[model samples]
Target: MQSNIKPVAYYLPQYHPIPENDYWWGKGFTEWTNVTKAKPLFKGHYQPRYPADLGYYDLRVPEVREEQATMAKENGVYGFCYYHYWFGDGKQLLEKPFNEVVESGKPDFPFMLCWANQTWKGVWFGDFQNQVLAKQEYPGIDDYTNHFSSLLPAFKDNRYIKIDGKPVFQVYQPLDLPDSKVFARVFNDLAKDNGFPGIYLLACNVPIYWEPEPNGFHGVISYLFHSFRFREKNTVFKEGSFLGKVEWKWNNFLEGKAIERRKKPKVYKYEKVVTKISKWPKMNFDYYPMVVPDWDNSPRAGNSSMILHGSTPDKWKIHFHNAVNYINNTSPADKFIFIKSWNEWAEGNYLEPDQRWGTAYLKAMKSCL
Candidate 1:
C-alpha cells in the first residue's frame, strides 16, 4: 500500500494571543476562545470539541509546536502548509510560531506557505456586516517587492517544501488579487532573483467555479469545502413552529439589521458531499485532490453556520482512499494531496486528537497513506 502521494495539511496559527486579535476579539483572545464558547446547534452535533492529547496547547510554547510537528510526521503527513497573512505594506498576523520555526530550526519539519489573501471581517463572530478589521490591499510593485523580500528568509530556509526543485507557494484566493497572473509572474521572478529555482505557485480552487487561466501558477489545489459546488437546492433547514417561521421570515427581511440572525443552520448530507468530491472529474492541469475529515463551522458561524452532518472516521477513510486512487490513476507524476486542515478546531475540522475520536482521524490518514 506504499504510495508516492505527498500529504500537506493546512495549519492555522491562531492559537496564541496576538495584539490584532486582542484588539479585535478582546484581550487574551485566541481561537481557543471560539472553540470554548461553541455550543451544539442540534441533536448529534459535535460541539465544544476538546483537545485530547494536545490539551488546548498554546502556539507560543515551542514544545507545543514540536509536539504538533511530531504528531503530523508520525501520521504520514509530508509537510504543513501554514496560513500566512500579509496585508499590503508588510503587515502580518499570527506569525510568531512560523517565525520561531524559521529562526530556531527546531522540529525539523518540511513546510510551505499559503497566503490567506483575504480581507478580515467580523463574520466569524456572527457580525457579517460592516465590521472590517483589516482590508487586503495590493499596493502594486513596491509593496509586492517588500512582501517577497520579507518571505525570502523563509523561502530560502532548508525546511521549506518544494516540488521539482521549485519552492511551493499557494494563494488561498488567487482571483481576489488585482491580477493573479501578474502576481505569480512577479513572485516567480523574485524567487529566481533570490538565487533559487522558480516558484511553484498553486492556486486554491475556491469560489468553486473559478477556472484556472494561463496564469503563472504551476497547478491548482482543490480546497475541498470551497470546491464543493453545493447549491441552495441541496441545502435544507429544519422547520420550526409557526411563530418561529414568521420570525424567521421577518429576520430574513431584516437580515442586515441584526448582529446575528436567529435562523436554523443549513445542513447537508456528508456522505453525499463526499461522494460528489470523490467522483469529481479529472481536469487538464495538475489538480491535487483535498480530503476533509469532517466540517462543522457552527462554532464560528453559530445558527448561520453551514454544516455537513454525519462525518465519521470510517467515512473519512473512504474519502481519503478515493482521493488517493484518483491521484494514482490520473496524476501519478504530481503525487500530491492536500488535507483541508491540521487543526481548525473552531470549524470542527482537524486531525489532532480530540475527546470523542481521539486519534482515529490520524489513524485513518496513516492507514490510507
Candidate 2:
C-alpha cells in the first residue's frame, strides 16, 4: 500500500489577506478569523481551535510555508494541490503566497494547481447566497489561452507534479465549464507547444457522475469523504439511509421536534460514515480517492454547516488504512490519496497540528504509510 500510494494534500491559500477578502470581510480578516471566532453549537463540541506548532502565522512569511512543507514532506505527503482561482479574463484571487513560492524557489516542494472555478457568494461569510461576491466565467478561446499563458511559468517549474510527463491541472467544476472538451484541447495544445507532453486534466468532484474518458479528462479525484452528502434531482430521503438521518429522526421523537429547521445543522459521526464511505462500490471507470482527517464547518457556516462528530486520529487512520488497500487492489495506477486539506482552519478540517491533536494526525498518517 505504501509503495503504490502517494498522498497529495489540498492546500488553501486564504491564510493571507486579499483585496476582495479584506474588502468583503473587514480590513484584516483571513481564514484564521473564522477559526478563532467559532463557537460550539452542540454538547462536547470543540470550537475556536488554535494552532500549536505553526502558531497564528501569516502566509506572507516564507518561513511559515517552509515549516508547512517540512511537516508535510516528513509525514509522507507527496505534494500540495493549491487551489488556483481564475474568475475569467485573467482575474485571480489569493495568488500571492504561491507566486512567491514559485519565484523564490525556497521550500522546493512539489505542487499542482486546481482551478477553483466556482462563483463566490456572501454565503461564505454567513450571509445569504443572493449576494454575489465574484462570478466565474469563460469568455472562449482568448481567455483560456491567457489563463494557460499566465500559469506557464508554474507549469514549467521543476517542482510541478505530473503524470506521464504531463503537468496535472485540476478542474474544480468540470460540469460548470463551458465546452469542456474544447477547454481541455486548448490546454493540451498549449502545454504541447511549450515543450511538454500534454496537460493532465483531473476533474475534482464533478456532478452528474462525470466520466473522465468521455469528458477529455485524464482522471477524476473522488471526494469520497464529502462533508455534506447530497443526491440527484428528484431524490428523496428514504428511511434507513445515512446514519445521520436515522439519528435525526430518533432525536426528533425524543425531543418532540420535527427536524425541519430551515438551514438546520446536519451532523454525522466520523465512525459511522467511515464504514459507509470507505469502499468505492466498484465501477467501470477508475478514480483517485480522498481521505478527510476531520471536518466541522460550523466555524464557517454557523448552524448550517455539516459536522463530522466524533472524529479521531484512530478513526481517520483506520479509514486511511482501508483506503490504501482499496486503491491498491482496485483503482488506477497512480494510487493518489488526496487528503482534503493541508490547512483549512476555518472549516475545522486540516492535517496541520492544532492545540488539541498535536501532530497525532500526522503520526497516524506516517504510521499507515
Q: Candidates' TM-scores?
A: 0.89, 0.90
Q: Tens digits of per-residue lDDT for model 2 on 223-272?
A: 45531354311234542357545543344233212112336567888888
CA lDDT for candidate 1:
0.80
User: Which residues of candidate 2, in runs, are more than 4 Å off?
Assistant: 1-3, 226-228, 232-234, 237-263
Model 1 misplaced stretches (Cα beyond 4 Å): 1-3, 206-213, 229-262
TM-score of 2: 0.90
Report the lDDT of model 1 for residue 269: 85
lDDT of each model, Cα atoms only?
Answer: 0.80, 0.81
**Which residue pairs in candidate 2 collide?**
none
